[model samples]
Target: MSLLSDPTRLAGLVTREVRTGSRDGVPTRIAVARRSYQTDPADLWDALTNPERIPRWFLPISGRLEVGGRYQLEGHANGVIERCDAPKALAATWEWDGKVSWMEVGLTPVNDGTQLELTHEVPFEPEMWGRFGPGAVGVGWDLTLAGLGSYLSSGEAVDPKEGQHVHRTPEGRVFIRASVTGWGEAAIADGDEPATAQTAADAAYSFYTTEPDSRPES
Candidate 1:
């Protein structure tokens, strides 16, 4: 069963399932189509590949974007560029522990705007992944997509730490709460018992909402 059985785990703003697979005893899967407001493929591509433009919307990144070139985010691990196609597609190896996770971003021009798709394929280890719940990865992607969309639309950066606590605002909090519930439903749909998923969802939400500075029993 998918490890996203908890509602709190599923709290990302956008997550579209694309495909799932397994390779060499490692489980690998894909999800595509995230958020981006820019309708022009070239614009979207620049926002993603240009290191200078990336930090304006997403996290700070420093790297050579050419194929087979290595790159790194200021606070993220370094990885090699696996594919690079101007105004259309980009893929790379996301480095972690001498191993690499696969990530791809695709841009497609649509009627209203450009559709941005992000696919990530990593070795799924239930023990580690389950600890954070599905929302761990999902919410992060949602925030990333939102940042990209905002940047493309108004050239504004969505800095969560910049005294504008989006996650704490009423709208932001509601969206997050609903996303957690949706994840709970998804968990049940994925074959987990309803009661178990619900219980896990509550626990996950508490973990996320708790103040980071609060201390537990020693």
Candidate 2:
């Protein structure tokens, strides 16, 4: 099977959880995506926090990268570093498009490798939720995780353009659709309506797999 067709190779390795929570008196939801990587906690943490190395796998980051400091991820979100702890956990404010969200990454030592769990919390906006379930974020994390895996295992940088090209093909659509469905079920388990979540999942799948428009806006 092609790499895209093989479920074990490029498919969603992240397990998801949706938790009902409250933020600033507004009912919100926290979507948690968890996955294990074939690297030790220290190496994984360094790959994540080290400014010099992050650009190799993820995006170029420029910021203080300290507690109560500020950070920017390339042409993406810029936020303050709410909390930072070495080789364990980090939390930050994800400020983009004039809105703010919370993001946290926790690392755990499991056997020989490390387990990474990313939790993103946002205020529940029905319209946005109608457009996509957690997969909108979940799939993005999956992409990052895939890149991290490639880098950690082979010491090679994943071409974002080439990776995206594959994700735009038919085989990529199959993987994306499965990711959306998985997130939809996760949302339902967190108390979302069945039909509504499915509709949003379909929209999310289409939004991610479509060429050009599917890519994240700068």
Candidate 3:
């Protein structure tokens, strides 16, 4: 088995939790993180606010990024920006019909770098929880954070195609494979069965790596 498959390594990088709904019916919560960018708050703010610069690091986002302005990614969900502050924070209601969800990204300046915090909240259901757990989203965030680091430090995007193609190489593959496996372990640690977590990780990795234009049938 690959070293990336090591359960301990995966667990070290993620934290998992399951919440029971309160009166408002809010239940599940998922958060993920990575360190090393040393992304100062000001620089991190630019990466998020500057339209020309957003795509180089994160997904190409198009929309008026003010509170209540509608936004869409070419192939991702269409949602309204729920909150925005120049370079420190953002939040949006992430939805697909009645399936309402929410995401928030915050930056805290540190002495050496910035700390990025991402929180995604979705209504919890037993079936969906079994399928996604926390790591499903956790691992994806890990990769995105890593990309952000590279972009901030080098002013160059880590080509997803190149990253996927050289996935078999020592560095590239290790990153991808470990991220996938780490997510699976996090899910299991959060109460999902081992087999279920593995399946979720496999499916998520496949979904992320597949070309956007050639998505597999749901």
The most accurate candidate by TM-score is 2
Give the TM-score ranking, best first: 2, 1, 3
Ordered by lDDT, highest first, the candidates read 2, 3, 1
Q: Candidate 1: lDDT of 68?
A: 83
Candidate number of the best lDDT: 2
Candidate 1 vs. true structure, TM-score: 0.75
lDDT of 3 at 19: 34
Q: Write the per-residue lDDT of candidate 2 for residues 25-99, one digit (tens) a residue.
A: 997888898888888999999999999889777888998889998999998899999988888999999898898
Residue 6, model 2: lDDT of 49
Candidate 1 residues 1-218, lDDT tens each? 11122323333536545344576878854434365454688778888888878887667777676888889877667899988888888888878657767888888888777888887766665653344334544444555666676667667655536313555555555555665555555556655467765665555555455554552321
Worst 10 residues of 2 by lDDT: 1-10
TM-score of 3: 0.73
lDDT by residue for model 3 over 1-218, one digit each (tens)? 22233333433444333333332655665544544346578878788677788767556778876788988764557688988886778899876645767788777777878766777776666665665555446655665665666677667776755434433445544565566777676556656689987876677666555565665654
Clashing pairs in 2: none
